[model samples]
Target chain A: MSAALVVLRKELLDILRDRRTLLLGFLLPALLAPTLSVLVPGWTADQREQPSPVAVVGAEWGGDLVYGAQLEKLIRVVAASDPEAALRRGAVQAVIIVPPDFTAQLARGRSRIVVRYNPADQNSLFAKQKVFQAVAKFSLSVVEQRLQQRGLSRAALSPVEVHEEPIPAGGGGLVLSLLLPLLLAVWALTGASHVASDVGAGEKERGTLEALLSAPVARPALVIGKFAATLALALASTFVAGMSQTVVTALAPAAWFDAAARPALRAGAVLLLAACAFAIAAMAAAWLLALSFFARSMREANQYGVPLLLLVMIGGVAASTLEGVLSSLWLAVVPFVNVVVAMRGVLFGRVDPAALALTLAACAAYTGFGLLLAVALLRREAVIFRA
Target chain B: MKSARVLVRAERLAKRFGTFAALTDVSFEAREGEILGVLGPNGAGKTTTMRILSTLLRPTAGRAEVAGADVATSPQDARRALGVLPEAAGLYGRLTAREALRYAGRLHGLAGEDLERRIEGLSALLDLGAFIDRRCEPFSRGMKQRVALARALLRNPIVLLLDEPTAGLDVVAARTVRRALAGLRDAGKCILLSTHLMAEVERLCDRVVILGDGRVRGIGTLAELRGEGGELEEIFVRLAGAGSVV
Candidate 1:
């Protein structure tokens, strides 16, 4: 066997024996997307279905006109002298303050109604929406009644009828298209980061690097072996995360899929996604391994690794949010962003094959550069013999 | 003695780390069937010389060869000819002693029955049979050293470079390592040992190379260095310089 293969086998075996790495590299990624997909929607649905408690300061003063029967059913009206205090303390989701002359003011022209709710609180925000809808409906009813008295139809108020015709949804609807690429970028970098440090700096810290270097193996072979191990672990994590997310998207209710995207699992699409994932994983592993080689110990590797990960994650988020990002050929040259943009394009059926090929080529180039840098660093006595 | 070929040779090796000169000028040779002790104190360039021999570091100037392979021109070949037991050599804690030896053997291109056979032979040779299958995490300093020794010898290297091989072992463990080195010397393997301990030199070295401030002060057998009969310590102190003695 080649020395690189031998070294790779030993490194992989070492990683397999580590329980912490196993948990981080495999188990955590497998559970991550499924947990978020299932739990978050389920929790949000429950919140939506349950009526929020709202405090109305002057319910009697409004005489059930402003607080109509339909509106009252959507929220349980609680009594409170200090409605604002109640909202702050979570005693109520929202506070609706109706003035004493609310009906009188409505007769004259318009009435002042204030809905106080915390925007930071989900339940409070939902309550505010419901309460505002009810008040608006009451005002519309009053306007319609007055219009009827004056022999005018509601059409008199709505002179121009605005018709909303949504453009046919493209790419795997907006949410899945954007979210999948972000997940891919995150897992690829995260998975590689987990093992790069251990494989590179951990070996030095444990004092095994010198022994390994003393072997008959070439320096490039040793580095390639270690790089392969790190890439394997990274690819494993990335693959698991992608598969989990795909399964979630497939199993999720159709209503959850935004736009026209609805879990389209074409062979070509799957292949494209797999290609994007592999490219991302390869680039991440090589970059992180290079950084790991530069570090003197595992602690220093982490200090370097975490920031790189965050920077990549931030780039991924930026790519996901950038409108029409896939159409731009310039993004195809950026490392993590290009992968994310390509993934989004693939998932949404907006793929530009030329752009994707460019992205792959760019990632390949970066990976090659990173591997070369790692090999060069490994050959440097100052780096290898660092205290 | 004249027929015994030189297996390890260093000629005018001078190394520097930018402004600091670690080795100014040093030369030595170890022949088959003998232990050559390179004696020096801390910062005496003992480790640096061993590192150069092991192909871990490059000498700034001069040349070195192991089993006829020049370390500078052909490091991989030089490494293949060497079995290096570095100072405070460490083991992979998760791997068993047997596994560690197998890994080392595989890297050297030994596999299948031959690799397993060599592992078994070294296990008996170093008395690693008791804990060969156990993880090295809880092994004592002596046990780890023995495992390291087994790994080094697995390649059947032409030249064995040991840097402070028994520096931290207990008396019993140190005796075991010393016995193993003596047996390897009798087996006709050239052993280049580096240490500052006078007793270690007195016990095992066929010839001593006394180094001070990266320069060789004396190189000869104990009897030859003693000349008119003197304590080895006094001679070492005098040759190596009294102020540099550790």
Candidate 2:
């Protein structure tokens, strides 16, 4: 434990002193969520505030559907000599081209609305839905007026009742999914891996590991201590990321921008999920660092470690949102998987006790595996000192 | 003769790497208060020979013992007797000079008041008082070497393996190191140091072993090795000359 403390303090100090590492492991994840939820979606939805362009050609109903004294206030309608030409020329997005019998069919309640658009146009689907909403509202008003003229109340001629119910969530989850990459995983890697390269193969390469092996501590205890220190840094990165997310979520309007929107996360669940996330991160860190004993230099170890950290982050991201991919027991036992899946479950407010248990059990199992990896690595002849 | 007091011995010590021979059939003996300098050019297996004696590397075919324990059979015992200063000996770059020595001491089972007192005492002797609390990364080559020496000396082991101990040192720094080594020698410590500098060998060593092409060419005092060749440098060249023996 004392040896481990020596390693842990050194690793943490290395990480804390690096400004870029602080920014990546602690800063990026917290800022990513709001940017994703608010900026991206807000820009995409901005079109709703603009007046939709509609053009008519050879329509028996004229622009009455849009510019009816009652509807005129709702839509801006334009007349075009060639309605299809207007749409093709980009003069208008959608043109309501009425058929010749459209006015007679309306008297008999047999009206049709044809919306022509290029099949490959991406936004046309959304444009079509908007057109339906506006046109449908106008049709309903026409029906009500027609009914009143016939001296019949619309509600008295009603049909069967209908009701809609929401389906329960399959999994509750985390905002860490989006925010973690920038804050915790990138820059934190250097501090987290400081002792890993230096202690493992770096020692071996420099011929110093033998001096360490000469110490009285049991081999496993030594490994555990080294493993613990490395694991601590990994957990620190995850914690930094988690804290950043909490602060940003609290302050960001994207998380709670609309008065009607509420994101319900139980305080206990947040802590439970964060704890699980840290556990997985720690195990992964220990195993990955211990594995780096094979690298010949700090530079090589980092090259090996970066890809591994990336794999962990990607695994975390995939596990959080990809329950289907993570369903197998194999993935559940993978170190970073347990943390991500549990976090996802917590965020979605559908945390299953069985899944949480599975996550913890898997993390424990991987910890044992990490111990085994350390043992195997430490036992090598090269571990003492090597070329 | 104090045969029972002999601290280290090696019989036919040889280490091989595939087809290449690193150390071939080398042997020696040492007792309390003797410094054996293994003088050779770089890549002449001085480090390899020391590594075997330190129990860091397994011998291919040899018998080596430290403090009466076989390095092959009783490594833990060999470890307890050995202190190593390897080439480019690494220190935790982030740790202070004091912390570096203390940490090495603690690894050997010293701690608490004992650890603190020993660290401070070692620091004062090594002239590390000024930089005791400073991180070791920014240190000059000589400073780093002193710290390594300080760590190696902290344990007061029966055997010390110093590889290229005087390489790349400035005049003042190298003299400080030499003085510390002289003190260790005076204190009845058995040490094996490797050096490229004949001056270092002449100044500190009681016996010098010259190696060439992975084999021992001769072992003697400076005067004896230089008898026919005039000076130590001339002797080195004449002996290391490829066709001279082969």
Candidate 3:
């Protein structure tokens, strides 16, 4: 136990000296997005709403127009001289014009209207279509009213009703999917690498491992001590990051974003523990063993270790993507996959008991494998003295 | 109860690396309150013998013991009575000079009052000064060796293994390490030191073992080795050269 503490203290001190943690774990995920958030509303609002003057151009106009109150909030109608020039100058999206022939064509019920605009222009298509719909609707309403005055109850005009029902996505599952973009993953990768490479490869690299073996502590004790220190660093960082992210999500103002709800948080906590246990224990073990045997130095191990971190992250992302498509309870029993599934379930509120159980099983299996590797690596002289 | 005879005992101990024999049929003993030097050239099995005795490596053949506990069967007991400086310093590079010593001290069960006092006393003895607090990353070869010596002194164990303790040290640093070892001897600790340099062997060791080609060629006092009245190296070459030629 004392031996483990020594390893743990030494490891923690090493991690503290790294500059990458500040940016990837603490700063980027926690603070970067909200800083960029202030621009979203203004930019989107500018694209949709218009409050400018514009020219009105109509082909053979003779349509009575009626506008919805909600529609009026976005656009203003105007008749301008030289409508083409107005559009070119960015005065409006398009122009609406009534021809001099006007109501005569509507009276005869045989008049056709021509909508005119430059076909080559950027806004020409939408502008052409929306103005045309408005004019046609207004003309139909006028015809209906005229027919009503004549006491005709014929079925000439009717409005089509289209109903769209939004399928409810499982609670907040959709929101959790967005976390892939931010580097919420950097901590796990860095933590695992720091530990495995430092204790295993770093020892080999620095030529200190042989000295440690000479100590009175049992071999397993040395491994356990090293493992405990690494686990503490990994678990501490992850839990802190997880909780902080949760708080920021919970209290960071609704306009900022909605956090995972209570149920998801509960699930997330469970999955997080499962993921962390698998990642830290399994990764640390495999890493320590592999490093002890293969690398001559921490630098060499880093070269090996960094790629693994990336692979885990990439796997995490891919596994998260598989949430709806390919993931099963069995995958949850696997190491990296289990964490991803569990985290997805917790963050999204859609995971099942079977999946969580399977993931737990996988974590246990990997941990056992890790312990075996550690013992084997510790005993190998070929790995120990390569440096 | 007044006499504790053997501090280290090795019998027919051998270490083989594939087709190469690092050490063969190596056997020796250091009694309590003595400094025994195991001297050889590089790859002469000096470090290999030290490693096996220190419990860092399991011997390929036969058995050895320290403090009367067979290292093969009771490695922990051997280690409990041991303080070692591997041929390599093996100091943790990331830690400061003081922190490394303190950490080692803590592991050796030196804590609270005992730990602090041991640290300060050793620091003054080693002339560590404020350099104790500085990270060992930029330390010179001698500085690292001194810190390693301090770590070895942490427990003041019954048996001390100094492996090339002054391998790359300057004159001053070498004197410091030697002086500290002389103190340990005065305090009545068994010590076995491994070195390639004959001067270090003559300066610190009361008796020396001449090893060559993975076996001991001769063992005696410095004067006994220099019976012909020439340099110690010439005698060492004569013994090792004959072994290699044969």
Best by TM-score: 1
DockQ of 3: 0.44
After superposition, which runs of candidate 1 have C-alpha atoms over 4 Å from their true positions? Answer: A36-38, A45-49, A63-74, A119-122, A159-173, A252-262, A320-327, B242-245
User: DockQ of all candidates, in order?
Assistant: 0.80, 0.35, 0.44
List residue ranges in candidate 2 displaced over 4 A: A13-15, A30-219, A254-263, A267-271, A306-331, A346-355, A383-387, B1-4, B220-229, B240-246
Binned by DockQ into CAPRI classes (incorrect, acceptable, medium, high), candidate 3 is acceptable
Query: Which window of 10 residues has the lowest lDDT sum in candidate 3 chain A?
Result: A33-42
**lDDT at A271, model 2:** 73
Task: DockQ winner between 1 and 2, please give it.
Answer: 1
State the TM-score of candidate 2 restricted to chain B.
0.91
Question: Who is ahead in lDDT, 1 or 3?
Answer: 1
Greater-DockQ candidate between 2 and 3: 3
Residue-level lDDT tens digits of model 2 in B1-246: 255367878788888877889888887777767787786666667778877887767889989999899988988788788888877676766667787777788677777887788777777777777788888879887788878877887877878888867666788778878887888878888888888787787789877777776677777767778776576766775665543321
TM-score for every candidate vs. truth?
Answer: 0.94, 0.78, 0.75
How far is B191's C-alpha from truth in model 3 (Å)? Answer: 1.5
Q: For residues A1-387, could you state the per-residue lDDT of candidate 2 as single tens digits?
A: 366565455455654565655564455544554455444444555554345566755554644664562254333466777778777776666766667777778889768868776555545445555667777777877888888999977675566666856443322223333344333444244445655665566566644565566554456766776666666656665565556555554455553333222234566876775677566656665666666666766677768777766876677566645667546455556656555556655666656777677778877777687678777766666644445
Tell me the tens digit of each residue's lDDT in model 3 across A1-387: 377677667666765665654454355434543333223432333433433233555533433342331154333555667776777665666665566676676676645545555667645544555566565566666777787988864364554555866454444324334452222344555555656667777776666776677778777766766776656555545555555554544444344332332223455455554464445445544554455446787778778767666776676777756666765865666556556656566555455777777776676777667766777767676666665
